[model samples]
Target: MSKGTRRLAAGLMVSAGLMGGVVVGTQPAAAYPSNCHYGISSLGTVSAWCAGGSGSVRAVAGCEWFGWWTTAYGNWVNVNQGASHVSCPWPYGVRWGGFNARD
Candidate 1:
């Protein structure tokens, strides 16, 4: 290859590497916790953590549930009675008690 072509190629590779690093570093580093972590609330409601926060929501017995939802900003979005036992992505799994529970 010509000297000019070799230098240009090397510069392009370095630029690509730096750009890749910046892109990866700027991405949001969020992940769902390993478990739903069900617990009793102050109101005596049997609930589990929504996806990524500490908020609780009442789970319906005998319904598959995704108790809480993690918002875009990595916060818990609590659910209400009207929201419980609703058709979710994986179907609500026996919400409250641990009866073949799933989400």
Candidate 2:
């Protein structure tokens, strides 16, 4: 192959490899924690506990008025060795709550 053609092919391969690495290394900002237990109450309380892992957990409450229109987020709790809890306090509406794990 010509030198110019070879250089172009090499540049293409390098760009492809770099792009692949970037994609593979990307991760979600929030994820479910491993070995963690979670629950939600009918009254819009959410809780979570991690038996293991070094991270933080928080509660998320989905509130509904006209529809599912608002979200109530709880404080971040360090769950490396303990539990986290949060509740939705919107009195005029119904709500569903869950948990999220943070790095």
Candidate 3:
């Protein structure tokens, strides 16, 4: 191949490599923490709530308990509730949980 053509090809390859590296190294904000709650408030808005090892909502204040009401406070109706993950009901609950990690 011509010298000028080869140099242009090499430059293109280097630029692609740099862009690929940057794209692969970055993480989205939604993928922040595992077992974190995310959704709207009681009045219907968006917020994020994280959970600790103790399994209680973390760093959230003045929020109502999600799912079920009255004397049966602890009871919930998550489609996939467990020690690892949970999915809340409507815009009135905790909504989503578990790691945002991709496999």
Candidate 4:
């Protein structure tokens, strides 16, 4: 065969191999439900729990206002107002009604 023909065939084979590698060599995508984010200038909430409701883990629901943040309860937390919340795995130590926010 001509040199150009051989080179073209080789190039196609390499490309096919590369595509196959991209398809077959990749690991499955992981699911991240908890490690979540809202968006720029948006509101978000997440929860962290302890085994027996005896740990003091502050899981924050955050609100971003252009760049700043605050608690959901309109308390100047740090940046903007947040709509965050909390949850206890065993429902023993954590209390209800606390985090609030304003527009």
lDDT of each: 0.41, 0.71, 0.41, 0.39
lDDT of 4 by residue, 3-93 (tens): 9999999999999999999999998653322322222221232443222211122344444444454443222221122323443332223
Q: Which parts of model 2 have CA positions greater than 4 angstroms off?
A: 1-32, 92-94
Q: Which candidate number maximizes TM-score? A: 2
In terms of lDDT, the poorest run of 10 residues in model 2 is 88-97
TM-score of each: 0.30, 0.54, 0.31, 0.30
Clashes of each: 11, 0, 1, 11
Q: Taking the tens digit of each residue's C-alpha lDDT, what string does model 1 give over 1-103?
A: 9999999999999999999999888955444333454543443334444444323343433333355531111112352212222222333333333211222
Model 3, 22-76: lDDT tens digits are 9998985443234555543454333344443222332221223554422111222
Shift in Å, residue 76, candidate 4: 42
* Full candidate order by lDDT, most accurate first: 2, 1, 3, 4
Best candidate, lDDT = 2
The C-alpha local distance difference test score for the whole of candidate 3 amounts to: 0.41
Query: What's the true lDDT of residue 68 in model 1?
Result: 52
Which of the two candidates, 2 or 3, achieves a greater lDDT against the reference? Answer: 2
